[model samples]
Target: MFCASVEQMKSIDRRAITQYGIPGVVLMENAGRGVVTVIEKSFAVGRGAEVLVVCGVGNNGGDGMVVCRHLLRRGASPRCFLVGKKSRMKGDAKTNLHILEKCGIDVVEIEDRIPRQFTRSLGRSVLVVDALFGTGFRGKLKGCALEVVERINRSRLPVVSIDCPSGLNVDTGCVDGSCVEATATVTMCVPKVGLVFYPGRRWVGELWVVDIGVPEQAIAEEGMLTSLLESHDIHMPPRDPAGHKTTFGWVAIVAGSSGLTGAGAMASLACLRCGAGMATLCLPESLNAALEAKLTEVMTYPLPETDAKTLSLNALELMAPVLKKADVVAVGPGLSTHPETEQLVRSLIEKVDLPMVVDADGLNALSGKLRILRRRKAATILTPHPGEMARLTKMGVPEIMANKPGVATRFAGENRVTTVLKGAPTIIASPKGEVLINSTGSSALATAGSGDVLTGVIAGLLAQGLSSTDAAATGVFLHGLAGDIMAERRTEYGVIATDLLESIPEAIELVLGSERGFFEGGVRRVL
Candidate 1:
């Protein structure tokens, strides 16, 4: 399913009208009707409820006008509050305001010295429709609008936002000014990218992609595709019965040291959980005993170790033999940054000839030396969080977080390495120069040994013969989904890395199973 931004959706909407001959007014009417229909169904207090419709002087305000009219039809008295002077509104918004005035809906011109007074007077309204700003807003809110949102928070009324919450960046999930805290949002046509990620999602609440008669073909014709992977998107047709284990491919992981043995174990387990046909963890000799007991299903090979228990240069010969037979190579989990250990990392990276996913200290070892990956024989995917990405890109963590999608796409294209920038809304940047944002995983996945597990999952996918793009995209999603399930089973703060490792099966089941969250609460329809 396509997850679009306000700008992208607007382009589609415009093309549908201009080229396809659908009038703008008719589209607006359909959009407004969809919002009202969702509101009538979702809001419990209706009919005689006192609904407060807060509208700005824009097309978004126009949507609020339509909502007010529909509420009136439903036998509710809606108190309409127009934020600015009537003369400020234009286009379809002006038309709706005129219709609202003639219909005798009391449109109050709020003369509060500060807009905070307006929200205080709203007193326990059954609903507050936030149509303050729409997609056309290019920056943060200010003055009266900011004041209005703050008091709305204080009023404690359930907010129903039309289109989008006021101050969210639709493309990036970055938050700037005061945003609406809606109980539910009626997103006409497709879901916004912002609603699926954090900070923006923190404000969007429960999202309803209310269809407004926009055909899928029309959206596709405009070439505005935001790839969102539901279970159906990841579903591949069933394989032939004759297919065997080798058909899935093989993955080798070069990871772990004495104290960091847990990282390699977690990753190797993820490889099997994610459906790798053959998976092996090759680690330093000294730690194999503890790791062998910790992990039984995964095959382990012990190599020469240093005094500090990190992999020594002598281990490279042993790793070379394994790398020759492996389809994917996952390196750099729990391999501490000792100089000799970093040298071992550099040698293996330069010589290995398999698809690679380098993560954690593996990333730290190659921090300023990305030129090494440019020399590899097979495909490469770097799974780096913003902190690691900052080290790779020579920028601060704040800068990387602010414009993640843009940075990931540009960097991956430039470096010729598939890059997965990990965090909320994890981004997968392909060597082909395309970027995808993943919506899986919970904040609960922010525990120890998580990155190591991700390295294993991606390696496992690569071993299964998936393209680097598909592996990174699917791996990030699956990793996050596992985190979400584990977090639900154990609260977000309580779920550990091992819990994420354990819940991979549950996440796969939820995706493949019959549960699809639709109308009503809690998504329990078995189909």
Candidate 2:
């Protein structure tokens, strides 16, 4: 699903109105009707249930007026409260306001201050519809608007916001002050960039995107760069019944050290769990025994080690022949930052022609010289948490976290490699300017060794012949889905990296089986 910024939304709206000849008022009518449909589905509106719709003077208010009309038709009494003066409402909004008055619905106009009666009305109503601001709104909510938002929030009434929450920046997902917390936001056209992001996402609650007659050609012409990753977007090739172990693909995981052997083991294990034909863990010879004991199915390559037990430069020569036989390589989980280890990582990255997924210490190894990533001939995917990304860009973690999509896009475009900026909503950016925001996963994934598992999952997908972009996008989605399953089985607080690994196969099955359902002899089964 495409995610549109405020500008792109505006452009699409304009194109729909002018080029496609779809009237603005028609779009508003469709939006209001769609919202009412959602409302009807969620709550029982007729039989004396009262609804309060608080609206501003813009087109968003027009939508609310239409909602009031629809509610009246359905045997529900809806009271419309205009935050601004009725005279200020113009264009399609004015037309709707006149219609509301013609229909004999109560239209209370509150201009300067919110009347005490408005607060009382909120208490009596079963639901509140917030149409005080649209996607064009920015900055803080002050004066009567502020009081109105706070009063509605304190009332503990369920709110359905139009377009977006009243005070959110539709693009950045930032709120200056006093934003409405809605039970659900009925967004028109495409999902706004802010609704899927944090801070704004919290206020948005459950989001429903309503089609308002916007032409698909109009949206395509806007050339949107960001997309929301869905399960249907992932494409997995059919397995050949005649194929052997090597037919699936081999993944080489170069990771681990003396104390952090678990990282390498978990990564290699995750790779195999995600359907890699074979997984080879190339670690310092000293740590190989421990990993081999833990990982029964994976093969271990004992590489030369330094005094600190991290892989040494001599290990690169040893890895050359192994990498030649592998489809993809996963590096940098728990390989400590010894000078020799960093050198080995740099040399291997520069010399290796195979696709690679670099994470954790591998990212740390390239901290000062991220430019080297640009020189590589093959595809490289960097899976970095905010901290690792900060180091690579020489920016602060706060800055990186604030604008993850922007930062990830810039780095990926510059380095000519796929970048997976891992977080709550992991973002995957391609060198070709496409960005995918992963919608799965939760706080349960905030455990140690989680990222190591993600590195392996992406490597496994890459080994299966997925393009770098598809591999990163699909891997992140599956990793998050597995974490979500683990959270359901075990509470979020108790979930560990191994829980995610164990649920990998189940996650894949869930995605593949999503379309399957029980059917009767000739018709679809109802139960």
Candidate 1 ranges beyond 4 A from true positions? 3-6, 111-121, 138-140, 169-177, 193-198, 236-240, 514-527
In terms of lDDT, model 2 sits at 0.88
lDDT of 2 by residue, 103-141 (tens): 998789887888876877888899999999999998899
Note the Cα lDDT for every prediction shown: 0.79, 0.88
User: For each candidate, what TM-score against the reference?
Assistant: 0.91, 0.96
In angstroms, the error of model 1 at 118 is 5.4
lDDT of 1 by residue, 1-527 (tens): 56787778888788777777887666667767777777766678656888888898988898889888878888887888887888998888899999988999877765444544355548858788998887666577777787888877778888988878878777776668678887887777777777776777888877776655566678988564346555545542234478776677678888887777889888888988877777788988988888788878888899998899898999998776777778888999999998889999888888877788999989898988889887776899999999999998899998887777778888887778899999887888886666676767767878899988889988888888788888888788788888888777778989888887788877767667734444342111111
Model 1, position 500, has a per-residue lDDT of: 76
Q: Model 1, 332: alpha-carbon shift in Å?
A: 1.0
Clashes of 1: 1
Q: After superposition, how far is residue 47 of candidate 2 from its true place, in Å?
A: 2.5
Deviation from native of the Cα of residue 465 in model 2, angstroms: 0.2
Question: What's the residue-level lDDT of 444 in candidate 2?
Answer: 98
